[model samples]
Target: MNTIDEALGAVVAAGDLAGAVGLVWRGGAAQVAAVGWRDMEAGLPMHRDSLFRIASMSKPIVSAAAMTMLQERRFALEDPISRVAPEFLAMRVLRDPDGPLDDTTPADRQITFEDLLTHRAGLTQAGFHSGPIDAAHREALGPDLDSPLSPDAWISGLASLPLVGQPGASFTYGRSTDLLGLLLARMEGATLEEVLRHRVFEPLGMSDTGFSVPPDKRHRRAGLYGFDMTGKLKKIDAPPGGVALPERPGDMEFASGGAGLWSTADDYLAFARMFVDPSVKLLSPETLALMTTNRLTDPQRLGAEMFGMPTFGTGSGFGLGVSVVLDPATAQVMRGKGGVGTVGWPGAYGGWWQADPTNGSVAILLMHNMLELEQLTAGYGLGGYGAIMEFHALATA
Candidate 1:
């Protein structure tokens, strides 16, 4: 059997990655491998504790926090979010998702909490659409991460745009969780960071996870890297389209619950443990069951598209915050492999984690596999996905 180090080292040597941290824990035993460099140019080695911009992986954490609130009877799943964020009360829906922004109709119904959780709120990211709607999203939501708008301003801006579909109609992946996080903050009368800290991080002992890296820990942060047009690894100070900034602004008020988070391998493992282990007790078993179970209808699953590919159907389903694996045989790479109820959500920056309840196991691979629009169009910067698949295969074996 190949060791984790040897398995991941091969990827680094192939120039597919600068470095990564891989971990697998099962039955009270753990295997951890830190391979390659945190910064190839700086000669810093990847460490188990090295911080990473976990991107959309932040979704699961925020969802869990929201679940905790649910358990407290703070709000019901069916409650309309308009009760708290009234900006959505009289929203419009785009007649055609890709058509002119002015061609719209009033929203058929109010968006509910569950709609946001399941990504059926009709909200969408700028990159998901083309033409007028896409431009509208970019103008409103500055970047996917570290937006300059305050939470209130951001919510108003998002509500001003027309939804891609009627609320609860179909799955349209977008800024739902980001809205959820801001709502959670509003409900708690605190910043999103404080709400998460009190609700999730502190309880899970995830000391290294947060929206920003403090000055003292700056050296431990991994430098972002991506592939150029030729498929060679290149350090990216700032990615195109402003998806992320090289340095997070100190006064930045936007805390993107969808894509903004920095965490390390062990800290995220602490978070993932709750899904597989009942003893962790982040939520009541009843609430946890609600969260991990598949929520999408068959049509919604089939209609959903992510990064221009069918998101579900093919042995997978989506729950509240995580993707549930229904069949390992035909599951897509993004869904990953595990038992019927295995749950995971991968980040855009090459971070992946899965918790298999049947096996009582967790597996994680964290890397900075940033890709630009042109690289994605040319399919030139996806070797890191291969690294993730290889790591999962080795970890399971």
Candidate 2:
């Protein structure tokens, strides 16, 4: 697995992965590679331009957009979110995480911009856990990936549910960023796509990045793949139609900040460059500094652990939307490449990327294969199977 083809082929031959596109940039040089098929059934070879449902990779981008809004004096991080989204004006907290729905208490205060940025807004996903709160989330907000409701309807549904914890309390990984997207749109009086395009995508020159793929670019869209019960690679679905994140007519109106965008290795590399290169100026120096730094309190770090997601490691903490590595020694537990102060996040669909501020390096691995959420929480996929550890480790070396 020393060469890119060999590395990707090993996984393809192993029956776990169908295709991969990876890029590593460091010290003003870049190495890009691709192997296997974007669609095995259709005999489509994977290319550097192949688009993948970047899942939570969308977080850092949306977070950057929010920072731009902050620079424009749209809203401060501490301002109550109710200023933009009135749905959150009066909110309730669950008395117990697993208790009945009616058992609740008044929130100590309204959720603020800072709370959503740090993921301490008491929001949580439904499918990852069990209990009444989880059920309520599923019934109200729909799945983590695709929801059938429009933006307004989705917020209406979310407003009806009780929060798992108090706002600005513990880190609960749910739809906080998605809610942020809606709020940003409301503030701009435009669609989420319009705001992100003007704020982040266009400036970064991410032409192929958006909530949905158009018809002409459909061929470049990687087919979603997953393992069958026998552990063999099975084609799941195609872009603009996958079950986890379908792109029907009205669905594009949501433009979820948490997990809605599709992008290529090169497109995301441009976005990653902003973190390490001051000249890129994708964000102001001070805002970028604050974003890459660890903003999590001690208790919030503990809550991140409870989620059991691979995006965070022992000595790492959540920043605005990305994970900040405070201690490289403890962060090595994830077996991915990075040093102290490295900032990045992984997508749900087997994508891993990191920008190492200390070393001036960026590594991105994009693939369409899906992994079980439990497997990801245990840190068994990206570095372990997709050779991301090897790819990124060699780049940094």
TM-score of each: 0.98, 0.92
User: Model 1 over residues 180-268: C-alpha lDDT tens digits?
Assistant: 99999999999999999999999999999998899999899888899878999998886456876778888888898998899999999
TM-score of 2: 0.92
Question: Model 2, range 270-376, lDDT digits (tens) per residue?
Answer: 89999888778878888888787788776667546445554455678878888888878677523234688788888767788889888898888888757666545
Each prediction's Cα RMSD? Answer: 1.3, 2.8
**Candidate 2: where is the Cα deviation over 4 Å?**
238-247, 306-313, 332-337, 372-386
Which candidate leads the pack in TM-score? Answer: 1
In model 1, the number of clashes is 0
Off by over 4 Å in 1: none
Which 10 residues in a row give candidate 1 its minimum summed lDDT? Answer: 238-247
